[model samples]
Structure formats: C-alpha cells, structure tokens
Target: MTASRSDALFENLLESAQRLSFDSRSPQLYELESGDDERHGMTPEWSPLYGTPLWNSLTEQERARLTRNEVAQFLGVGIWLEVGLQVALLRAGHSADPSRPDIKFLFNECADENMHSLMFVGAIEAIGAKFYQRDRALDFFGWIFRHFVWDEVAYGVVLAGEEIFDVMQRDWMTDEDVAAPIRRAAYIHVVEESRHMAFARRKIRDRLVGLSRIRRAVSTLIIAIGTHLIAKGMINRRVYEDLGLDWEVVRANIDGNEHHRMMFRRAAEPFIEFLSKEGLLNFGARWIYRKSNLL
Candidate 1:
C-alpha cells in the first residue's frame, strides 16, 4: 500500500464530497410517510426477529413497527460509534503532515461523519424510535474508543464496524421495499463509507507491516471482541416491547433462527476472509467471532 495509492483515494473522496453532501434536515426527510401502521417501513427480512415464531406471529402493524425500530436501532449503533469516532479521528489525524493528501481527506471524513450522526438521529426521531444506550461497561469502553484509539487499531475497529453496516445499508439502498427516506440516508452513508473503509484497510495494512506476530495476534483478538460488542449491541431490547413480545424469548428465537444466522454469515464472509488472509483472524480471534455468530 503505497502513499501514492492513498493520495489518489483521498483525492477521489474529496471530489465526491464536494459534489455530494446533504443534511438530515432536508424537507424530503421530513416528508417520509408515517410507516407506523404500514407494511414496509423497512425491509422485513432485516427485522431482528425475522424468521422466528414471533415474527411469523406478528400482525402487519406490529411487523412494520418492529422493522422500523430495528432499522432505527441499527442506525443508533452507528450514532454511538460515530460519536466516538469523531474524537478518535481528530486525535489520530491531528498530527498528520498538512502536505499529505489523506490529511485533508481525514478532516473531510470527520465532517461527513458528523453529518451522518445527525442524519441518523433525525431519521430515528422522525420515525419515533429510541436510540438506546449501551451499558455502563460498554459505555466506558466506548468513551475510551472515542477519546484515545487511533493508528492501526482504530482503523481495524473502523473497518469491522463499517463493513457490517455497509453491507446492510447497501442492500437497503437497492431494495425497493425499504422506506424512501431511509434508502436515501443509506445511499449517502454507503457511498461515503466506501472511501473510509478503503482508506482504513490501507492504513491497517501499512501499519501492520512491522508489527510482531504477538502484537498482531493480540490486536486481532481485540478487534474481534470490539466487533462482537458492536454486533450484539445493534438491537435494543425495548424494540420488542412495542409488539408486546418478550425480549428474552424473541432474542432466543433470533439466536436460533438459521435465516438470521445465515444473513450474518453471508454479510461477514468477505470481511472475515479479508482479515484471515491478512493474518488478523487467528485462533483466539476466530473464537470471539464465532461467539458473535459472525463465523
């Protein structure tokens, strides 16, 4: 991964950013149909409880509400990570040489994330869904992630989070059944994040070159653990209560549903393969990934 390649990527990203930037406050966002009692506020297949007995038993209105809430919660996780990333990014790039192309692009990336968080918050609020909070321990870790991490580790975590979110959002952007406002948001995120992920992956590769096997192995486990937390944190328990379903029961069913598991496996396949080829998917880290059902 040459600095020249990074410079080209950054140049392209900068041009893309200039040509396309948006706010969450657009009238189109406000015009989103009330999907509360409708059939498709979100693509039904993405509901956390999808393919479970609970999902099959849900009424049309209930299903709509659940999927809408599920999508909101997914975006909620992005909001959580993005907030922390804003800090991490600033600190990481704070000392970069101004002459480097990626330096300017780093600040541009930060601005993009700021807008994305606002967009997610606006969409969730518009849909009347809750942006659930992480537990105390996770919150503390999240704060640490937001405030301190950078370098190869931050980009490692960044790629894990972005890849999963990108895969899902890419599907939404093309699926007609997904809500229009949500699709628009997804499209914006996917486009911008493609550049971010490319940049992060390159950074990881560059930094990994001289790291010892022990350090790489340790970092791999940490990255896998971080991803596991993010994956498990996506669906808030309260999203089920709107349908009068028990969270524990619904979660149990979702855990057992081959359909949902397969979805995750498929989405994570390329990412896992990439990490494995790069030697970041070691034995210990593989176990953590399996625990999260992303294996």
Candidate 2:
C-alpha cells in the first residue's frame, strides 16, 4: 500500500485499539515502577505446567542462576517492549478523525500493555529479583525511531512479539502452579491480547496484500527475527556468563550458531504452519521463505 493508504489502515486499527476495556477482575499495584506483587507475598511465580518435579530437577545453582537472570530477561524484553511500544505506536498512528475505531482499540491496548508490564515487573520483584536493566535486543528495537518516526514495521514487530506472549498466557493462566491473583492477571491479559493479536495480524496482512514485494520483504524479516530472537527461548547466555564463559564467545555462540534456526522454527513454526494450512500464505510469503531456505 502507498504511504497514505498505510496511514489510513493504521488509523483504523488505532481507533479500535483505544476502545478495548479491561476486565474488572485484573489486579493493580499502587506504585507504577515498584516490582512488588501486592496480592501475594514475595514468592517466585512459575506456571504449574512446569511441575515441581521439573522445578526440583534443576540443581540449586541452576535455580538461583535462572531466578535472577531469566527473570531479568523477561522483565526487560517482555515488559518494556510490549507495554512501552503500544503507547508510542498509538501516538504515532493517531488520526485526526475522532471517530476512528483503530485509535480507540489502540488506546485500550496501550492501557492493557501498561498494566501487563506493571504486573509482570511486580511479579519479578516479588521474588527479590532485579529488573532487566540492560538488554541489547530491547535497546535495538528502541533505537529504530531514527529510521521511521511512526513506522508500521515497528508496530508490527511488537504485535508479533505479543503473539508469543499470548501462548504463554494461555498455558500458564490455566496451569495449577500460578498463584490465584497472578492467574487472574494472566486471564485478563489473555482476553485483551486476543483482540490486539487480531488487529495486528489484520494490519500486517492488509498491508502485505497491497504490495507483493513489501509482503515478501516483511515475511523474510519476520522469519529472520523470529529465528534469532525467540528460537531457543532459553537462558543459556545467563548460564554461560555466570559460569565465566567469555561474554563475546557466548554472544557469538548465540548470534552465530545455526542451531538457532531450529529454535526459531520451533517458536514460529506453529504460526506459519497454521497460516499455510489456512491457505493464507500467499505467493509473496512463499517466495520470501523459499529464498531464505526456511521452507
């Protein structure tokens, strides 16, 4: 689509986003930045799906190491990226038309994202863990403002990221290990994010359908990022660094290794397979993955 058309589509989505309301059952924190869970005492939250056996399976060293590092990673990347991006994207995509539906939906989405981040951070802090203060992945996405002041590409990336979180939300909210308050929070988030995911997919799909070339480029970029960022979804780096592995070597292993291809595919394979089976994987997407050898 042309810039003007893309802008219009964004406006519509933003209008809808602003109108989404939260379930009354969700939790709240009196402090925005304090990472403390007011409902439950300071205990590390884990999905029941991660059985106690699995929890016990980890050695004490592994448990403590992950308790800090992995928690930090979750707070930094997941919270900031998901919450911070929504408001920024909405402000950028807002239109002059007050009646625009997308803007309304986006507003609700931003609110939901903010609440989600606060709860997530609070949970991290509840266990006496530190906030993820330094993360290159989060930094890189934050810095993309120089390229396009209000780029849809950035918005689309955040939407895709939310889908990843949605899966965990669905699984963990229902699992037995989650605390009652936290489970309520997850359930509320799952409902709100469901709408956000639909809008995100619509915005990207419509944008792609308008331009075969851009569609191909977007699909390729999403695949590449999916591979590098979320493939393993493991805490290997924190482990390696804690073990005194050279930071550079650890970074190289994570960044340069081919094994991440599997990880990426594992994380995204379900989505792609769903699209393919639904016959929504178009020629452009096929071409992009075909050239990348991701088929």
Candidate 3:
C-alpha cells in the first residue's frame, strides 16, 4: 500500500474511534430481561456439541448453562488476546514516532482494547459464568508473540483472532436467543473491531510488500500455529467438567462434530481467503489450518 493510502486509513480509523467509542460501564448496556434465563449465552449452533446425541439429550436449562460457560470461555480467551495485542501495540509505539497517524491510531486501538477487555470481564460476570483456567502453553506462546513478532506476522495473527471472533459475534449480537449481556457486548465488540481488523489487514498487506520468500514462509507458519492455538484455546475441556459432563466424551463429540467443524470453517473462511490472496497460505500453513478445523 502507498503511504498516502495508509495514512488515509489511519486517519479514518482514528476519526471513527473518536466518534463511535463507548463506555463499557453504561448501565443500559447490561440491562437484563425477565426471561434471560431462557436465552443461550451464545448461538447454540456454534457450540462444539451441537447436533450430537448428548446435546439433544440436555434440557433447555442444561443447554443454556453449557452455552453460558462456552461463551464465557470465548470471552475469557478474547480478553487474553486483546491484552496481548495491546502489549504488542505499546511495544511498537515505544520507538515509533508519536506524530505519525498510524502511531496515534495504535494508541487509540490500545484504549479500545482495554475497554473491550473490561466489557468481556463484565459480560462474563453478568452471566454468572466462570472463566476458564489458563493454558500455560498458550500463555507462553502469547508472550513470545507479543514480544517478538512484528509487521505482517504480528498483524496477520491479530487479524486471524479478530476475524474469527468477528464472525461469531456478528451472529451472537443479532441472535435474539443469545443472552442480553453477551449480545450487548458482542455488539460493542463487532463495531469497534471492524476498525481494528481493517488496520491489521492494511498493515499485513503493506508489510508483506518486499518480504523475502524465506521470511514469508516462516511468518506464514508462525501465524498458522498461532491461529491453531487460538482455535484450540477458545474452548477449555474444563468447561465440560464444570458442567458435569465427561470431558473425554465431549472431546470425542467435538472431534467428530461435522457441524462444529463447519462452523469453524465458516468463521475462518474470510481470513483464509485473505491470507491465500496474500500468499501466506503455503503447504505447511494449510496443513496447520486443516488440523485446526478452520480450513
């Protein structure tokens, strides 16, 4: 991308951030309805166990409870990703010229991410759902990524997470069957993250302009691995145990879940297409994505 085009993108993103920002503490955002207990915490079809015999056997209340924990797991992972992104942005900003429009936008994005984390935390609390335990391996990978990854690789990984969540949140925000708090949070996230995704895409495209073939291949593999970890980390096996279900059975069901696999592909399709067009989906990356069930 040209410098002029990049500058314009940042300027427009910054303008939107100024005009459309929201306070996560707004009481209206957390308003609950009388029958909220009847609602799913996420779209039921997105559940890993959806269409399985176990899922069919559950009472509506039981299913709702499971979905509540499932969505909370997603929100919890989102918060973790947002925090890592913020750290990466701040580190990038350290040596960057503050006068640059992109740097300004970076700081603005950090502020937005902070609010998003707060919104996720509040939503998890509102639904009376517990957060999943941290995966130490993923946490270590996040640490390495935030501190070391840069340019196309960094932005590509960020875009993958944002895009996957964006697809799901678009569904959750509009689904009347979803919980009120989750819907409200999803709405806010979808609105703000549109700008973030645009910025990441532009950065990835620009950064890849003259990258060496070897570097591009390495970056592609790293991004694919990061995406795989993110896909796996979104749902904790503990969610099943906490809900009084057998983790092995749930894992088996998820592994065999054509519906769940289809949902993953649907959520990831846009990013996969974008990556392919950018020449980031080499043989190795494609294999990783397939294993993640996101191809």
Top-lDDT structure, candidate number = 3
The clash count for each model shown is 0, 26, 0
**Which segments of candidate 1 are over 4 A away from where they belong?**
33-39
For model 3 the TM-score comes to: 0.98
Error of 2 at 228 (Å): 3.1
lDDT for 131 (candidate 3): 91
Better of 1 and 3 by lDDT: 3
lDDT of model 3, residue 165 = 97
**Per-residue lDDT of 115-220 in model 3, one digit per residue for the tens?**
9998888887887887988688789999998899787878888899999999999999999999899999999999999999999999898888889999999999
Q: What TM-score does candidate 1 get on C-alpha atoms? A: 0.92
**Model 1 lDDT on a 0 to 1 scale:** 0.77
- lDDT string, candidate 2, 23-51, tens digits: 44234431223332222221234211122
Pick by TM-score: 1 or 3, better one:
3
Ranking, lDDT, top scorer first? 3, 1, 2
TM-score of each model, paired residue for residue? 0.92, 0.62, 0.98
**Model 2 lDDT on a 0 to 1 scale:** 0.51
